[model samples]
Target: MIRDVAVLALEGSHAFELGVFCEVFGIDRSDDALPGYDFALVSATGDSVSTRHGFDVRTPHGLERLSSADLICVPAYDLRVRQPDRLAHELRAAAERGARVLSICTGAFLLGEAGLLDGRRCTTHWRYTDELARRHPRARVESDVLYVDQDPIITGAGTAAGVDTCLHVVRREHGSAVANTIARRMVAAPHREGGQRQYRERPQPREGTGSLAPVLGWIEANLDQNLTVEAMARHAHLSPRTFARRFQQEAGTTPLQWLTGQRVLLAQHHLETTDDPITAIARCTGLGTVDNLRHHFVRRLGITPQGYRRAFRAPHNK
Candidate 1:
């Protein structure tokens, strides 16, 4: 029933986050055995708008297109700009008429500006949680989750979390099968759990400009291996305590927590893409046993691994 989607590219938008909307909703997936969404990029003026990334995007439709949309997305934009009364009015009008309104990253700032977030539970990027709260005292800003869907109003965390939000919308609208299909085609994991709390730890600064990037890359590639803090610290030529601290600083989480999250992500990818049995996938992802994976998957994603697989797997595969 969610046929038409309209994304509002406000002035000073972030290109990558806006592109997330397009990639999830605008791209045609019918050729790949998935349903397609009718998506449009619109602006207030129906003109070319510049993004924070130094690129311009053109929108043929103006605010008028928002009236007929089943869903509306507002990508991140500069909050310092003077909010136009007319634009805020239109956004509220659309939401009042039953169109689902979503915001990606700092786009929640606009919703706050429009007064839509007042008394509603929402979230924004972790970096802006304080600011969002300070600006709109009535809005309850949840900084932990990747996204919050308060029925018709939804808000996502920063950057890549926008993809999760969009796919979530797809899942809620069409079904998990369609959303997972699209995620596979895009080479993105269909689900992440435990919210942005997992990303709140500050990573250590680079060791004398040597860059922890290589170390992080190595960890990702060797996720299946026993990745104890001692072993990882030995690899980095640091004491276990220092390594743990640095890992948290560099990776934004303790090594164990980060590893668990990565393994969970890998498990989710396998659940959505491969026909491998849960036991096999669990072993491959270093999750020990099917029971263990099931526990963690359920705890994190709010569903058992089998249930997730059943919801996302193609009919024939299921």
Candidate 2:
């Protein structure tokens, strides 16, 4: 349902973060069979805004453009510089009027300044989590998550996490198939578990552990199998305990947790794109029975499988 989109082009905004919004929402991708958004870059005074990287971003739009926006994006900006006062006030008012607001990296500072972070769970880049917490005492800033989605307010951790956040919005509003198509166009992951914790600043994986790409790919191809820790460990040529530890190191999640997330994602895809019965979808996704699939869909997405299909089934399928 998110059609009208406006990005707040604040002065000194980081170009890449702002570009993230543009790449996700600004482009005309209808040729690829994806939905097109009414995307615009709006500034405080309808003037050009200079980025931190010395380039100027301009659009014939201002804060007035936000009044009709379904979603507002705030990208990373220099925290040391003060922003226009009206930006914060209007943002607060927009969210009050049911407009979802998303922040990228230090952009969470603006939401904090607008008082939107108060009493809400949010996150920023790991390097800035402590600072965000210190600035907004009432905000429950989670340190390690890729992003935090508390309905009207979504916050991304850092640069690349912005893609994850925006794709999530598309997935939530449209359906997994649409989101996945958009992600494929961008050559990015269709989904990354938001709860997957941020890894430490390590240059490389620990000495003995090999890359996990093959194992992950194998897991996806074999989701219908009775996968267990021992089974996966053997495939990776490691003991169960070591495999668990190494998976945590490389993937930022336990193997089983990641497996469950993939199953849920697959089930979502089936629900949105296929007319298969719930039990059949469950069997294919390795969720076992209808009860198990419904339990996970409700717990993770707060919607029943049948409800999800009714709400999000492809137009052609319907």
Candidate 3:
């Protein structure tokens, strides 16, 4: 249901973070059978805003663009200076009017300044979690998760984690197929496993970096196959315990967790794209039984298969 998206450009905003919003929401991907956003960059103060990298980002749009936006995104910025009161006021008002608000990295500070983060479960860059907590004592700052989705407000941790949060929103609104297509175009993971806590212990993988790419590719291709820890361990040439540990280290999730998530995603694709019965879709996705599929779908997505199809199935397909 989300269509229009407006990204807020503020003084000293991080260029990469802003680019993350543009890349995810501003691009035209309809050629690839993906939905295109009615996207625009809006500045609160003027036509041009300065970035932390000593460059200015110029946009034709202004705060007025935000009024009709279905979602408003605020990217990371230097939080040392005060944000314009008008920007904060309008952001809070937008959320009040049922517009979802998303913040990347330290942009959570802007939400706190807007008083939107107060009494909500939120998070930010791990480096600033304590500061965010201290600044807004009323806000429950979770330092561990990749992102926290408290309905109207979604918060991403740092730079690339923004991708995870955005794709998550897409998956929630559309379906995994759309989200995964977008992820494929971006060459980013369709889903990430762990939290910033895991990243804190080690460096994040650089772009085009992943140790288990081959195994993961194999698993994805074989989602309907019976995959077990022992089977996957053999494929990865590691013992079961070693593979489990290495998988967590490399993928940020346990093997079974990843497999179940894949099955759910596969089930979602079937529900959205095919008129197959729930039992048939469950079997195709490797959930084995309709009850098993129902259990995982409801537990993970909070929606029954029929309900999800009702919401996201393509009109022509339906």
Q: Could you estimate the TM-score for every candidate?
A: 0.69, 0.95, 0.89
lDDT of 1 by residue, 73-162 (tens): 999887766556777788899889998899988899888878899999999988899999999999999987788887689999988888
Alpha carbon deviation, residue 233, candidate 3 (Å): 2.6
Best by TM-score: 2
| CA lDDT of every candidate | 0.81, 0.90, 0.86
**Most accurate candidate by lDDT:** 2
**What lDDT score goes with residue 175 in model 3?**
84
User: Which residue pairs show collisions in model 3?
Assistant: none
Q: Which residue pairs of candidate 1 clash?
A: 202-249, 203-249, 203-250, 204-249, 204-250
lDDT of 2: 0.90
Candidates sorted on TM-score, descending:
2, 3, 1
lDDT of 3 by residue, 23-108 (tens): 99999988888888899999976599989999999978989999999999999999875678899899999999999999999999
